[model samples]
Target: MNHTIPLALSIAGTDPTGGAGIQADLKTFQEREVYGMSVITSVVAQNTIGVQDVHHIPLDFIESQLKSVLSDLPPHSVKTGMIATPEMMEMIAAYLRNQSIPYVLDPVMVAKSGHALMDPASQDIVREALVPLATIVTPNIPEAEILVDFQIQDLYDAQRAAKVLVEELGAEAAVVKGGHLKGEAVDILYVNNRFYTFPSIRTNTKHTHGTGCTFSAVLAAELAKQKSIVEAVSIAKKFITDAIRYTLNIGNGNGPTNHWGYRLKNIPTVKGENHHV
Candidate 1:
């Protein structure tokens, strides 16, 4: 007997350390019970400490990889991270224009170590050509500033930015992650003309290398199961929070979150969320 499973695709860079990017994405997909596919945009030589080097894949090959998967597997949901260039963003944008499945866009700009992952100019293309196609846009505060063109200094600012991503940039919804901020790990979501506050206790640890990639990957996986945007993001929040809480202390510097931590016994996954309308 054969079993049908939800399929998810991640188009992004590679983290050789297995902490972030394609590796993190695949881990989250597998953990979420989704079949995972990947299209690598660049090969990055990065570890817990910092990025050592990067070799971008040829644009033609990138497109070829996309075509190979889209024509064959055709994922139930799709997501993107570190689509580094204007040309690449445009290419992906063209393919996604007609996509009806859930598309979670993690606007990856800089690495956790402050290495630039995307071209600074690609911000315009991401706003103009890509964000609108997103089923949901997940941006940490820094990325939110670039996409929304303002400083997000606090929760209100994050709330405003989340609203801008959906109302102004035309994303179906947006979640402005507040990891860069102080206090509780509060993420503000704006969708369907309302706001939601998902707060979980901040783990005092440095093993959060691939938090964004893993979080958005979970969103894609949950959405592939046909869960609503709020439900998907809520689940993503719990997964990332739990993953961070357990803390995988493998690397020397900012290490990776525990991909399987959420499944750990006696781990109080996440707290309840609050609504804001």
Candidate 2:
């Protein structure tokens, strides 16, 4: 038998804390047995507690970084996180549209530490420029509401919003994350008029700093391996659930998830890598 590692790329920001952003994405890729590369859009000074400050990389630098990686080891799949500014989002959209790789967009509007990472004025640019090119867009409840410009109160509302996002925004699929729901953690996936509900018992720990980045990265990894969108999401849901269950209390506030949650023999095994892209 042969073991070959698939390569995946993350075009996003750098998190010094290693909880979210490029660090979290890379860790998730490694744990999933894929080679991970990154193009940093911004540099963030943050920890599990929160984002202290963010400095955007020059637009030219961002473009150069993309060309540098794609010109060499083109990724099997790509995931976008924490593209802080509208200009950065535009650049990413143009680059992705011209590429032939599968991509996942994690609409990271707000940081876990309660800081707004996106510009209010750039919402339109993101929706117009990037959302349509996504293989799938993973938006939490709050982010979904902003995209649809309406409040999503229940499962029904989420379903409605997902349909709109697919029909209007042109996303191939929409995963309306129900982590913010009052009780259990339920992620709702709406595609092709079918709704899949992924439910999990919520963890009591506050160490959920990198949950969003981790989830999207896992989804991208699964998709790159050729899993169907639904299958990829299912794997991601299980990965995140177990990660939250085994929460790492590494920081004083919200800590990070274990990207290597399934690496050990004792850990739960995910399905085989399909290698689509």
Q: Pick the candidate with the highest lDDT.
A: 1
Local distance difference test values of all predictions, in order: 0.89, 0.82
Best by TM-score: 1
- lDDT for position 108 in model 2: 88
List runs of model 1 lying over 4 Å from the truth.
1-3, 267-276
lDDT of 2 by residue, 1-277 (tens): 2226677899888888898889999988887778899999989898877778889899999999999988887888999988877888887888898878778999988655445556768878778888899888999888888788899888778877877778899988888998877887778777766777777778788888889999999988887787889898988988887888776668888888877655432544333222121
Model 1 residue 231 lDDT score: 89
Provide the TM-score for each candidate, comma-separated. 0.95, 0.91
Counting clashing residue pairs in each candidate, in order, gives 0, 6
